[model samples]
Target: MLTKNRAASFWNGVRMRTLAASPDPDEPPRMVTVPADWDQDAGAAFAAMAPGTGRASLADASMLWVGPLADHPQASHGLATRLLDLLLRRAAAPLPAVWHGLRGSAPGFVLNLAAFAQPEGGLEIDDFVQACETLAEAMHLLQPSGQTPCSLLLSNLDACLAALGLDYDSDPARAVAACLCALATTAMHPHSVPSRPGASAGSVPPASPVPGLTRFALARWQEAALRGRRSGRSPTHELLPETGPIETGLTAPGHALASWTDALLGVEACGAAPLFSPLRPDGRLAASTLARLAARGMSPEAALAASLAGNPVVAIAGPAATETMHRAITPFLDRAPEAPTEVQAPMRAAAGGGRRELPARRSGFTQKATVGGHAIYLRTGEYEDGRLGELSIAPARGSPVQRGLLEAVSQAVSLGLQHGVPLESYVETFAYARLGPGGAVEGDEAVGSATSTLDYVFRTLAHAYLGRSLPDQPQNAVPAEEPDDALLPLDLPRETHRPSGPRRRHGLRLVG
Candidate 1:
């Protein structure tokens, strides 16, 4: 039986309606309600979700609710306090914070200082920096001892920059980022003496004992990112200032920004800590990104090779604050079997051709057909956007050798597709290939005739995926008709034969 005290400890005084333990199958389910200990405002915020959305739990240890400071500038302090209080009660000690959403655990806490995606011209530069300053002050009040760690994230910064007619990879935007980082760092260390200009790395003043923000970083593109665009979303181009761009893995300026900010925080750089991670879900490049690369006449393999060349290894900062974070992450070090010997450069020169991965669960179909009495089965898998990503080919009736050969071919094709080889290239190469099994195709209306099973397979793929309908070759479809104007073969007027006599006798007669 769960007691009220036990429930209080588990839920941190949050109200919960749950079923009581009952062994009796015949007994009715009894609902138990535990009253909340927190105030009504936080409780109501926790219980009632925004319309058109389901309720979410604050009890999750990994989650950090970063309320929009732009929406409620005055409430930043109160909101931060309430959230921190709730988290402290619920989350385990030395809270976990994830900086890189891709390859690392989340941060203990993340706070949004400004809503950068303002489409309307209402946002001002002063206002944006002011909001950050205000949030920093609020954070200091909540954690005056600097014991509790928090990170500041600027959401929709890219869209905000675009709205202001600023390029993401330019100097002006970086100036804005530097200004924000400086302000937050000052607020975080209000009592500590400022470090002198050009101070030696070892001569910088020791960090303050007061609790404040640990560092700052740019946030990834959100679902609401497209809203900030005056002309609306684009099919070809994606908004900039994201964690990483599709065209290039990580922008050079973005990486420099992360490194600069971490340096401002007086810490060493680690793997994608202050900004973006190059890794994708499947530990490979995304099929869609590869396809886009292929469309641009760029070779995906070449791009990958260039990006991975001479990458700087990563290391964790040795500060005492990072010790707990380090211990928390030790278990996940070996999670990825192919993780590099050293972490990819956290903040360094820009690299291209990042891994694009298929989702754990994918969508696709299987196809069956016959070419000249040969049974062939074709299966395909697609990415999230229904782009063909994987292919499998098999023969229903074939010897072990033949089956092995077909399997090898399918595997090769599938790798090519994933690596950004266009389907058109494959279709053009194999469409009219001639071999055995020349005749009609069955179980598919798209292809009527083929010279070989390979021909039928590629032709069908061309019609289905590329929308290119290829006509069967005349020689393969039927025997070619002879032309009346064809030239006749010529023969020698007289046939010449070697002498039947031995060479020695002929030589002697000639000499005599």
Candidate 2:
């Protein structure tokens, strides 16, 4: 058993078992290398399929990427190459089937291919311009009708064209700009009646007078004199030579002067975009033009507010909530503006003949009293644990008018809540009522009275039970009083006595 040959055989068997039980330590891991030329080839293929680009080269490259030749070391290499091929093919052919395929695939590859198709520094000016045009055309063809996809492609195209210093006069940039403007116009004026059935196909106006394809465009055109000023270049004459002559309708002499004044003021407020911003420095509208629109009764603040409030689902509940909120609060300035302040209640009683109920709770202890030109309503009731409740509303503590207004507001809120209206909807309705035409009088009197009553009830309950302190009432405290004539009568259930425990003694005497 101890022989050298026998021992060597035994060691060999142990080694074999160990090797089978665990992974090999001696063997190196298999190495893989992805071809660096893959991205370049894919990019070339995509470029070829672009409009004004070589379609044949694109097709050939796409076939090579997707075929057996694409069996590269990197697993993603084949997929990436194939996607580029498909993108180029789609750009060239643009069939509905290809569009469906694109919708299902990763957007990253398509975006990358678009980026690659843009002109690089190494490309000659003519070649670069041609590539830019082709890329623009492809992007225009692929632009989605739905908002999300359209926004993505629109943003990409804007960036690419801007980098190349392409203007709206250029084929692709102009085409793409037209599409974006259509989207913006649709968003702004969805209910706009079409001029004619088929004539409205490509008739979307830009958001503002400026073709703000990007944030930079907005910045560039925000100011008055600086709007068309780009590196001392006159944008109107150089970039947008097609801009038609400004047409002014006949107006009264006084109105025209006022309009000019308004325009001058607007030009002073906003400024131009910074140099660092990414946008094409062209297509800005003049401040004077915007002023004219304002003179025609176009309130920017009101328009923005309407836009914010119109979309019940998305702008309110979705990603645009914050933006909507900003729009809703935007302010406007008008000549001879009145000072902003809360409404004051008049001393005269409302027109109603009937002796209205006092805007106070029906709690058994307090009373309504008038003091210092204001009404003060006191209330008392039982709290959650049978504790005493007390509360008071002294409208005259600040201003008699303000007190009355507050009382009315409180009443309206309570009545609306009691009627099962949602809090938000009720608030919006109330705000509208106060601000809308022929609504002020109704809100101040009738609506206010109802809300005041509700406020009294809620305050009485809240003070009696919900407040922090829970001290017992004094023994000699004033006795409970009867409810006011205006208040609705409450019917309380009668208390009955009950045994606390079983009467064992009645059945049998227990001996301990």
Candidate 1 stretches with Cα past 4 Å from truth are 1-355, 475-512
lDDT by residue for model 1 (1-512), tens: 22232243245444543323211224332323223443222232222221112333344421333343223444544544444442333211111222112223222222222233233442343444444444444433333343333334322233333334333344444434333333433333322212322223222111221112112211111112223344344412232221211110111122322222221111111121211111222234433234334434557666666545732111111111122222222221111111211222221113244324445445554567788777777766677887777665666434335655675677567656755778888888888887556688888888888888888888988887878899877642445445322332343232245466532222212121
lDDT of 2 by residue, 1-512 (tens): 00011111122112101011101123232111111222222222223222232222333433442343235332333343434433433211222222223442211111211232233331122322233233322332333222212111111222333333432123434433333323322221122211222232323322322233333322322332243333454322122122111110111111212212111111111111001111111223222223322434545555446436642110101112212211211110001111111111121123232222222222233334332123444433322334332222332122224434543554344333333334444333432222211111111111222123333333233333444221222323344455333332345322244366632223322244
TM for candidate 2 is: 0.17
- Prediction 2 global C-alpha lDDT: 0.26
Worst 10 residues of 1 by lDDT: 243-252
Top candidate by lDDT: 1
TM-scores of the models, in the given order? 0.27, 0.17
RMSD of each: 24.5, 27.2
lDDT of 1 at 465: 81
lDDT of 1 at 114: 25
**lDDT per model vs. reference:** 0.39, 0.26
